[model samples]
Target chain A: MSTALSQKLDAVSGNASGGHRVNPGELDLSHKVILYLDGISVSFDGFKALNDLSLTIDAGELRAIIGPNGAGKTTMMDVITGKTRPDSGTAFFGQSLDLTRMNEPEIAHAGIGRKFQKPTIFEQLTVFENLELAMKTDKRVWKSLFAQLASDERDRVADTLQRIRLVDEADRLAGLLSHGQKQWLEIGMLLMQEPRLLLLDEPVAGMTDEETERTAELFVSLAGKHSLVVVEHDMAFVEALGGKVTVLHEGAVLAEGDLATVQNDARVIEVYLGR
Target chain B: MRTPLSVRMFQSLPRTAWLALAIFAAIAWIAIPAAHLLLPESSPFHVSAYTVTLLGKILCYAVVAVAMDLIWGYAGILSLGHGVFFALGGYAFGMYLMRQIGTDGSYGVALPDFMVFLDWKALPWFWVGSDSFLWALIMVVAVPGLLAFVFGWFAFRSRIKGVYFSIITQALTYATMLLFFRNETGFGGNNGFTDFKRILGYDITSPQMRLVLFGLSAALLIAVLILGRYLVTSKFGRVLAAIRDAESRVRFIGYQPTQYKLAIWTLSAVLCALAGALYVPQVGIINPSEMSPANSIEIAVWVAVGGRGTLIGGVIGAFIVNLAKSFFTVSFPDYWLFFLGFLFIGVTLFLPDGVVGLWRKLRGKRAIEDTDTPTETPADAKGASA
Candidate 1:
């Protein structure tokens, strides 16, 4: 009945969509880099959360960032996802699109999705509905009112439910799910967005060993199709992911190598492990 | 081949819901009107004029309750400024009613008595088109819709939410009430608009006109329910629920919470304004007091008493509370406010999900027991907690 939102959306899509469109051509990863952060520094109340931090992720790479508390891991995710603006930094998605210039929804629309540290699935909604809400589609206010689930879209939800091992629990409210199930549901929701890069913060914090192993397998399998930047504190899960581990300390990278190599580094051992 | 519009509309509601609607329509459109207009005064089936007017007023309230539920229940936005929208609609239509008084006012002038009494030379610019019924109808929607859109745009854009949003809305209505109470604003001052003589060249107080307003109110409530049902059942509804639960999660999934919230908020306001327009013709008064913060709070109470997310709950709640109000104010006028306070407290304390949720829980438990399976225990537990 009201075209107010449609008009605003028209203005937004007209004014902001040009530079931020997610067309594959503009997402050019010919250099093989999916994410690039250079000289990023963020300070709050004069305490540096991130100082001169720079990192790069190869296309479709699963990058595990291991850091102690206050290592700027979450802040880094915030910056890339456009939640927090860094005081100084150039963050790029692929090569053409700038992450710092967009808002959270814009960054998400541009193919970057972030999962919070805690499991943040829509608890009141059924697992199926949660996935449906998160599914990649025209999310405009007016369009959503008449949107019917296409057969292919329904199949996509079913496929995701199977992949996330929540097929049996599809009808159940997500709040009723166990902690690990909620974690998986949140991941399934992220996958529904079809994000090019997935930033997961401590995704396996409360999972059982079996669930943790399963999640690790899922993340490993997801690599090469979806670039994952998993910020995890669980050493075992990180080891299970078996990807490149970047150890962060004092707001900067302390070590960069395989898990074995980082574990063996003298400085890494002194600051994080040797203690 | 696309489905026919009528067939699709019919299929929107389940058979049971349709039956319920049919029963309601029969009473509102056929039974009650027949009882009032056709039955002799001595007949037991004869409905009194006072009762018809009261029921008509409640029906108007029912429309407002449903609108409140759409935003507060479904969108998780608690707006205490909704009375402003309702009052705005009433005033918009009231202007037309005043103009229709023609040269019959005590001042014997073509201008409304208030304008003549205030020594105003002519109608205000805002009331220029107030003589046309079509203009009144347009203003009924446009006025509140515009206000809500502007207010909601700024509020939602700044991400003001939860209790803060509620407080701001309360302030909004309170301020509007104060503004309307001023004579300088040219809206009849504290007396507001009343003593209407006619509408569309027909007697406003005639039995036929009263029944017409009553039936229109019922139709509006029914339409609001159907539209609300269609909305909350769509993907948009699911996204709204998701936004309610986890707004940031919705943002990360690429949906702007502000746009969705603003759209629903404005729609809810427009619905309330329509209810108010219908309300003025039946109750025969439109005043600044209609925009009072307390009146808006009572609306939330109706939704909460019925169940927030369930559209039917708001209607049931409006009927329950208003009927109770009619009884209490007549019998114990002084304690009516106390009774309302206690009712709200009781509903909030013991019935968090409102009456509809309680009904669902009772039914769910019975079904669970009938099936009797260990796998259903979690669902049973969820019902209890929910």
Candidate 2:
């Protein structure tokens, strides 16, 4: 199992142009963890969704969390983002940032951005305006009253459009976008927020192969710049993402290794693959 | 008819054009007072004192309606007792006017005519120092502001919103009306404080005074509308709409909505009070009946009848409703209330957005169709299997 983890790392080391790439060295894992989670528990009506679980991600690391349905993956994301505060535990960001002490918006302002299972864009606003608004920029009364998008601000918007690859469709209404496009726009909004940490829930839940590939391209490009924690059920997409894959089962880390080792593990096969 | 051509031209024009038109209307309003001052005394288009006074009264109502819109249309707080605030301001101003009358009153006593008629020995405690115009102006702004603050603090803190908030506000106005109706309260009871002698030493019935009052009211109405626009277009206004659309979400967005709600509520009250201060001397009365809950509810009708979210619409609605009211009461006095009730029902049901909203729909340009789209982008199906 250790070899499996190191072997994936070794491949990325060997080929600068590695395929099915999982970079063990792109992120400085030796750096003190940015987000720390330990002994976190949440229950809904006596059912323990997140039991005594613990995890940590280094600053700028892209860690993908994979689990079957009912594995408490969504709840874990909820706990980190402050949507659902744990019944008990210490969830911290950086050295002294106690996430448990904050609320959702505070958490968002504290540099954690969450993309929910469903997109919640301001439907009334246009696509570009939605992204601009999400930047949470120009919060001043004067800026809003004057309402002239400055030249640099306009350039930043254009840059974000290019990064999201929605520059062509910047003028299109967000509602008019295709499902894949909407998902990309939502991701674009989160990206424009320029969060230090991003918790993306099921980002590839329903994507065409082309879109999925492009999203993989997008995430791969983003890995070194921002610490990404993606919770998804798609193993193939996960493999495409190529990171330290943590397989969560019944609210605990059942296995942590490359997919081949986890796939062949008897326990993981029974709990997740059902083989 | 050439109506369709004009309508098409209007529809095809940009939002800037619409804003330009509103600006022109305000300039024209200021022009009226200028004409009264400078134009020949008997020129046909030159405004008469009576006409100016009547228009001034309409302008005062427009200010009140704008205040109503600030709360109801923007904040989603429907205050059904706004008339209480307006009346409170009027009575405050009236107190000063009363004191100005002094020994010139019908009874020729130090106290108001009603007080001397009732055989009062001295001035009431609340009536002290009300003779100063400066003090009266302070009371005009403060009385309503403080009351709204107290009322809003309790009601909003309790988390009582929607129709319940509306009903409680109505009850507040009704109770105040009954309280002021009693003669022993020293507010002239049912007679409601009339026989004004002077406003800042100018003869109350002087035509020049009436014209000046008209200009003041018109200027104020224009100022409030401009202020309302500035406020509604700000980030604060976006948060207000967010509160209106989803309060919980606003909290999640890192803002405590109560402060925002209270600020706008107090602002609306102050505006209404200013309107009342302008309203009283022009109309020549400051009666307790002004506090009637029905009048407050009618303010809501004005906001709805014009266009709730649009501030200028509220002013237009107030002007149209009252003009219709004047025309209707004179022509068919028996059915005025019936006409108003049905008018409100028809607007709410059919228009939903109000007349300005309907007009925007017709115009099509700058129409913000808020709810016609679905969200939650579905990830590509192939990506899911991948």
Candidate 3:
């Protein structure tokens, strides 16, 4: 598996000389690790947002990262998604593509999809269109000008609408959707991308209890098919995710284990969950 | 699956839209020209040259309005400097018209009167191929398209958007206007280019030429409407609207908003340039004032008044506003500016969706389900901030 991964990386680096067509989204998860960040450090205007943040997510792993405010959960996601460049360290998708070198669109095309803390769907477009735009396809300007949805693509969109439970609201303007529906629609958009890694920030922030449970179930079902990294403040929702929980504090990992184990850690209690 | 371009273009508009276009084409190509040329001067149906020129001029303005709408309305990039592209196109074509004068100028020195007056020995480097009609046509699209491409590339890459983008565009045109006003610029100084004798060896001032130019303007407007309709309905247009609403979101979704914005921005500029090229021959004048910031702002007003995002709205808006301008300027010249100011204010407050939206409401029909209306979307809260 590692040999296959190295060959892929070799071909990627030698692409100019080899004159090979570089197909995106063919991420090398042969080593069973979908992501890697080692000694990553980022500072903003003299303030360190992330310091020596090292983390890894194995393929098909479901992990929840929780921390107090300004603990760098979002900053980590930003670094991973190429929104914020790190001052130092190595961040890799699979084993070859450097996260630090790529831009947002490049990173996204590399099979990493992020759902912001606030649902950021295209509000002016219809609900179905939001998913369509997010679909994994040739998104070039000239191509999009004449793009017509293939039967399979349309079926996928319809399928995503059902999974996200927005089938009824598919035709409605996204702006008119309720908050929970918008969240689902956004998730549906992510699903349409068929990403390898899903970084969800506060996915259940404003959802009702039932909606929150449904979202939890959806995330659980998505875990084996896609690696999930969720950053959330809701302990109940995190507990419902039922996965290895990582505690972040002051821009670095403080504790990492099962939710119960992390909850019992003294340092985690001191920095986050208190007596 | 991609459909053939010709098939897609033909099917872009509805049958009703096609019918409307056919009627408009009949009037412009057959009726108006016949009235101007075939009818006797004493006949009521006789269309005077002034009326034909005025209508031709409005048709040109309508094209500008649609081009403005393509960028500002659908893409949400309000450029208050489209006048530069329009004027640049005018200057490029106007150069050809000036050269067509040969030695018929006041000095008869084989040079344009302005160049002779400035005591210039030869044509400037930029005017080397001014005599070639094909070269002028190429320059008409190339100059504005290149400028727009480069300008849009830099501006969009830096993520300049919203009101800031609007301000810079205004500044761009204002600066261009000032530069053109200089005697050293070689574009006929403040007077610009005028006093054309012929085009392609045919007398330009003849009734035949006027009708030809007028017909061409009408044809261009129809073509623009069809093209604009094709664009806004395409998946590409949906992406444009999406970027307008949430640019950062678009970036995260694996689509480079800069490319889309730049493509549309440059295309819009080229469209405006085409309109400007048609405008110069019909109006018989191209001056530095055409690039004024105020003129650019007026183009936005036409799009706004017509109801943006709907291509047809731009045509209606241009006719309505320019026709009103002609009337008010002739009758109550002093009050025209004030009236215009009030018109804009009133439209912003009461007719937020412009005349088309109001018409939709009055008819008890919803706006074309697909027409993107800024006010109706809750998108402003997020609005291209990233």
- What DockQ does each candidate score versus the true complex, computed on alpha carbons? 0.49, 0.13, 0.48
> Where does model 3 sit among the CAPRI classes?
acceptable
What DockQ class does candidate 2 belong to? incorrect
Off by over 4 Å in 3: A1-26, A273-275, B367-369, B372-386
True contacts kept of each: 0.85, 0.20, 0.76
Pairs that collide, model 3: none
Model 3 RMSD in angstroms: 5.8
Model 3 per-residue lDDT tens digits across residues B1-386: 34467766776777788999999999999999999999999999999999999999999999999999998888999999999999999999999999999989999877899999999999989999999999999999999999999999999999998899999999999999999999999998899988888999999999999999999999999999988888887789889989988998899989999999999999999999999999999899999999998899999889889898888888999999999999999999999889888989999999988999899889987664455332222222322331
Model 1 misplaced regions, further than 4 Å: A1-25, A273-275, B1-9, B365-386
The whole-model lDDT of each prediction reads: 0.86, 0.76, 0.88
State the TM-score for model 1: 0.92
* Candidate 2 Cα RMSD after full superposition onto the native fold (Å): 10.4
Off by over 4 Å in 2: A1-31, A43-50, A66-78, A136-148, A168-178, A204-207, A245-275, B1-51, B71-81, B112-129, B146-192, B235-263, B287-292, B364-366, B369-386
Q: Write the per-residue lDDT of candidate 1 for residues B1-386, one digit (tens) a residue.
A: 22343444454566788899889999999999999989999999899999999999999999999999989888899998899999999999999999998999899989988888889998888888999999999999999999999999999999999999999999999999999999889899999999998999999999999999999999998899878877776667778888888999999999999999999999999999999999998999999999999999999999999987888889999999999999999999999999999999999999887888788788774211111122123323433443
Q: What is the lDDT of residue B33 in candidate 3?
A: 93
- Residue A108, candidate 1: C-alpha displacement in angstroms: 0.8
lDDT tens per residue, model 2, B1-386: 11232332343234674686577566545677677767887887787766677778888998999999988888889999999999998999989988888799877778888988888999989888798899999999999999999989888877789999999999999999999999999898988988887988889888677777877887787678667765664446655765676565344334456777888898999999999998998888888889988899899999989988788788879988998998899899999999999999999999877878888899885555322111112111222332
Q: Mind giving the per-residue lDDT tens digits that candidate 1 earns over A1-275?
A: 12343343334334442444344424656566889999999999999999999999997899999988999999999999999999997999877888888899888877788888999988877888889888887789988876655556768899999999999998777888999999999999999988889999999988999999999999999999789999998988898999999988878888999999999899988887565
